[model samples]
Target: MRNIRAIANRELLSLFCSPMGYIVIAFFLALTGVFVIATRSLEPGQPATLRSVFGFMPIMLTIFAPAITMRMLSDEYRTGTIETLMTVPVSDLQVVLGKYFAAFLYYCVMVAGTLIYVLLMLIFGSPDLGSMFTSYIGLLLAGAMFLSVGLFASSLTPNQIVAWVTATIPMILFVFATNWVVSEVDSAPAIREVLQRVNIWKHMELFNRGLLMTESVAFFLATTMLFVFLTIKTVESRRWR
Candidate 1:
């Protein structure tokens, strides 16, 4: 636990020291703000709303979460810090968990940034607080899952660019391709069912509309844990080689 906290603190500090974190936050805020303005219209009678702002988050997260996590283990290995890290008294699992949690926390900040949009909407118009809360909950879970995938990709290679691309490709597939697959396989009920099951877009659809489904929650949790474990295994396997 002590080691985990130390590792998490180090990771968090690294993020604060780096300019990339600030850049990411700025880009998302600007992009989401534009989305809100466009969706709500420029007219004074049509005030801005949180619905459109939150709607942009999943796509933003799909891109930004990889940027935040793609370097987690890969950068350490690239710079030869992995050796020093491995020599520490901490177990590998603790290191992986700590780093994962730190990245997760960073992603949470990204999600929290959208709160400003919610506040703006509240000032302009009535917002459904319950739906807003559930929507943000869904974003949190989605970000966690994406971060876990990025961590696993980082563990697979010492090249950060390669890790980032690898992490991003599957997310793109999950977000875009699965829907296409479902559309194409109209006659194959079983195939469509499977594609829907694998589709992050399908799972996220309900959440975006403020519908809280247990199955979607379970899917996100399972996907996150699966990738986290994969990352732990990837890191552990390197010890033997």
Candidate 2:
């Protein structure tokens, strides 16, 4: 626990000192703001809400999450600092968790910055509090899953750009590809059911609609753990080499 905290703190400090952290945050907020305006303006008769913003958030995070986590391990390998990090008393799991938490925390901070949109909705409209809370939860869970994927990608390569691209592609597919396949392919009902179950966007949509389904939550949690486990294994492999 102590080692994990130390690594997390170090990762946080490193992120704060780098321009990428601020860039990600700023870009996210800017995009959200634009979406909020466009959404509200385009549907003036509809309730003044952030539904459109939330709808766009998963896609935004798909891009932003990778940018935030691209350097988690890739930079360490590039700078030849993985050896020093591995020499620490912490186990591989601890290191992976620490880095994962750091990235997750950074993402939370970025998400928090979007609170202004919520505040605006509150002042001008009666947004469903329950729906908003659930939506936020869904966003965080989705972001966590994406971050884990990014971490796995980072662990695979020494190039940050490659890590980012690798992470983004899978995330895009996870959130969209399944839905596309199910729509394009005329499959049996059972096959379509399985594909729908695998659709990350469908799970997120459930959350967006204020449905706290256990299956969706479990799907995100299970996938996140799987990637985290893979990242730990990747790190351990490097240690043995």
Candidate 3:
């Protein structure tokens, strides 16, 4: 437990110390402010809901999550530090989970900044408290799933760019591709239903409506664990090298 926390702290500090981390977060917030809040949230006489923020988050996460996680294991491999780290007392799973949680923690900080928008809504109008709380729960779960996917991608490649693209493609499919397929094609109701179920963004829609379905929570948790397990296996592969 102590080793895991140490490793997590190390990863978090690296992000806080670097310019790229802050730049990505700033750009993410800028985009969210301009495109989501400015366009829909701050309008007069509109429903005081975080629907716009939650609706826009998956797309932003598809980009931001990859950018944050791209360098985790990939940079270690690039610098030959993975070998040194592997020789330490910590186990492979600890390294992976430590880094995974670090990325998750960083994401939490970024999302926390968006809470200022919630405060803004509070002053301007009556936002549904229950729905807003559930929406944050949904975002955290979805963001964890995104971070896990990015961690798995980083475990696969030594190059950070490859890691980013690998992670982005799956998230894009989850956020956009499935929706487009269901919406554009004149498919049967059954097929569209299946596609909607597969769409990750669709799963979070319930939370925005203040409904915490067990199935949605299970889906995100199971998928996140699956990726984490895959990353552990990938990292373990290096033991033979």
Model 2 over residues 121-178: C-alpha lDDT tens digits? 6776777888889999999998999899999999999999999999898778767778
The true-versus-predicted C-alpha distance at residue 210 of model 2, in Å, is 0.8
Give lDDT tens digits, candidate 3, residues 142-218: 99998899999999999999999999987887678888888876758888877877677777888899989888998
TM-score of structure candidate 2? 0.95
Question: What lDDT, from 0 to 1, does candidate 1 have?
Answer: 0.82
For model 2, how big is the CA root-mean-square deviation?
1.5
Clash statistics: count for each candidate = 0, 0, 0
The 0-to-1 C-alpha lDDT of every candidate, in the order given, reads: 0.82, 0.87, 0.89
**Per-residue alpha-carbon lDDT of model 1 for 1-241, expressed as tens digits?**
9899999989999987899878887887788768876787333577333655565666676688888888889998999888888887878899899999999988778768878877766776677787778788888888899999989999989898889899888787677788788888889999899888877777766776778999899999999999999998888887888
RMSD (Cα, Å) for all candidates, in order, is: 1.8, 1.5, 1.7
In terms of TM-score, the best-performing candidate is 2
Residue 87, candidate 2: C-alpha displacement in angstroms: 1.7
Q: For candidate 2, what is the lDDT? A: 0.87
Per-prediction TM-score: 0.93, 0.95, 0.94
From the highest lDDT down, the ranking of the candidates is 3, 2, 1
